[model samples]
Target: MTLQKVNLQEKFNLFQEQWRPKIVGELNGQHVKLAKLQGPFVWHHHENEDELFLVVKGRLCMELQGQEPIWLEPGEFLVVPRGVEHRPVADEEVHLLLFEPAGTLNTGNVQGERTVENLERI
Candidate 1:
């Protein structure tokens, strides 16, 4: 198969819905994705892996239980420790680079509106 060079815009274009992640690439044993998020999400955590979120545009906030929420701006990134419960709240539409395993659900253990069982590609 011929190799394809997909850019950020191409990946961004693939995102058509909110809180859904589209896999873009893979590094080592992890999958790299682009997700568009807005509004508040349920508190959850990855039981077996650390998840990293890097804001590509707009503000993204991570609220930890009983702790100050962490705000990520464009060019900023945060790695939430594995098994640490956290909720994500976005004031406006935000684009992000999500690094996690291939089967990782964006909302983790929460089975709600935001969970995409079959993660799409953007």
Candidate 2:
């Protein structure tokens, strides 16, 4: 078993593909995913689960249904409540860590661009 505290940053570097998330670790039923994002992602939402996003390196813009949206940096995080439509945009290459369920789709509610079907790590 793994006994050391996992460094999310190192795990994120294992994958060089954008939007493709790697299952790094798990905590409290939440699957920790490390992904590098660029460009804009499809607009979607999770109908039954809240998604947590933490920027590990760059900046990200997350637009929610009825809110002003949030811009997160390295130490910033945003918990997108369940059932809310949101879109993520990255002006530059960004490294991020996500907290959601194991089966939760990266695209969430609707499937289109940026949807990763099968995820495998390096």
Candidate 3:
């Protein structure tokens, strides 16, 4: 098997659309995804999957139900456990790296226009 290093900036430059997650790597039934985020996202929760959000650029405010917002800066990360309703809000364009189980939906329990059923591999 051949192994290659993935460049995060190069992969991020391949897409400009916000809220769309592009797969960059996979391991142990999990996917490493990259996305550009702005504005607020839907409030949702995963039934059985935990999500890890790593801020690559800008800032991210993770809003949990009935809780104070958790701020994440560049090089910081947060893991939202399964069954916890949460939302991500960005005041400006933020580059993010997400680690989640394979086939995990971006919108989780709530599905609507923002749901990305098929993710593109970069």
Candidate 4:
């Protein structure tokens, strides 16, 4: 293993696509990912792994089934519990930091257009 700094600004600059998550770091059995999101995402749930989303820039809305959407701004985070159906919607471009198990799929159990089975590290 080697020690190197992971600069968010530099990492974020590596991509421009929306809803695609890029790996930035790994800890324990989890992956620390960065993503740029815009528009609405599919409503799905992780059957086994909990997902964490931290807004880095702009704003995001976490919409859970049967519940009011939770709004998150920069520095705010939300942990979507395993098996809870939810979707993320961003009116504008949003920068986010995501933490989840290494093999956790971006689309959770549902396979759709936004599903990412393999994510590249930046």
Candidate 5:
């Protein structure tokens, strides 16, 4: 395989869909994905895996069950523990980098309009 560098801004420019995560790279059974998010997302939890969300641009709000919401700015990241109920909200367009198992669903336990099973690679 040929090794190559990934440019975040360039990768993000390829798609305009919101809530859809595009795979950028993979390693050790995990996928590195990039996505654009806006509005409130459904509440859900991963049954067997933790999810890492890194804010690459704009703001991201992580609402946790039984706790105050956490806000993330560019260069910040949050790891949602497995089985913990949480929802992500973004008032404006937010760019995100996600690190999780290759088969991890965008909507986790709940199958909804936002669930993306077959992720596209950028």
Candidate 6:
């Protein structure tokens, strides 16, 4: 594969859908994804895979079960461990970069209308 640098803003400009994640890069069984998020997402957890969320713009409120919400801002990131139930909420449009195992489902263990089984590569 040809190696090239990815511009976050340029890649983000290619899509405008919320909750849907687009693949940007990959390495060592992990995928670097970009997504635009607004509103609340389903509460779910990966049975085996861990997830990393990095805010590129706006704010993210990560809600953990039976605990207070953790807020993330631009340039900030949070790692949600495996099997830990969590939900991501955004009051406004938020740009995010996610690092997780390849083929990891956006909806985790929950298979619902919001689940994205086929992720688009941008």
- Best-performing candidate as measured by lDDT: 3
Best-to-worst TM-score order: 3, 5, 6, 4, 1, 2
Lowest lDDT 10-mer window, candidate 5?
105-114
Instruction: Give the clashing residue pairs of candidate 5, or none.
Output: none
Residue 83 of model 1, lDDT score: 90
1-122: candidate 3 lDDT, tens digit per residue: 99999999999999999999999999999999999999999999999999999999999999999899999999999999999999999999999999999999999999899999999998
Task: Please name the candidate that would achieve the greatest TM-score relative to the true structure.
Answer: 3
Q: State the lDDT of candidate 4 residue by residue for 1-122, as single tens digits.
A: 77999989889999999998999999899999999999999999999999999999999999999999999999999999999999999999999999999999999889978888889988
Candidate 1: which stretches are off by over 4 Å? 1-3
CA deviation > 4 Å runs, candidate 2: none
Q: How far does residue 74 in candidate 2 sit from its true spot (Å)? A: 0.8
Question: For candidate 5, lDDT tens digit of each residue in 1-122?
Answer: 78899999999999999999999999999999999999999999999989999999999999999999999999999999999999999999999999999999888899988999999998
For candidate 6, write residues 5-88 as lDDT tens digits: 999999999999899999999999999999999999999999999999999999999999999999999999999999999999
Weakest lDDT window of 10 consecutive positions for candidate 4 = 109-118
Q: How far is candidate 4 from the true structure (C-alpha RMSD, Å)?
A: 0.8
Least accurate stretch of 10 residues (summed lDDT) in model 1? 8-17
Minimum summed lDDT over a 10-residue window in model 3 is located at: 6-15
lDDT string for model 2 (38-94, tens) is: 998888988898999999999999987788978999989999889889999999999
lDDT of each: 0.86, 0.86, 0.98, 0.95, 0.96, 0.96
Candidate 2 weakest lDDT stretch, 10 residues: 6-15
For residue 65, model 3's alpha carbon misses the true position, in angstroms, by: 0.2
Off by over 4 Å in 3: none
Per-residue lDDT of 1-122 in model 1, one digit per residue for the tens?
A: 67888688777975568887888988688999888889998899888889999999899999998899899999999999889999989999999898987788777778887778987665
In order, how many clashes per candidate? 0, 0, 0, 0, 0, 0
TM-score to native of every candidate shown: 0.91, 0.90, 0.99, 0.97, 0.98, 0.98
Worst 10 residues of 6 by lDDT: 1-10
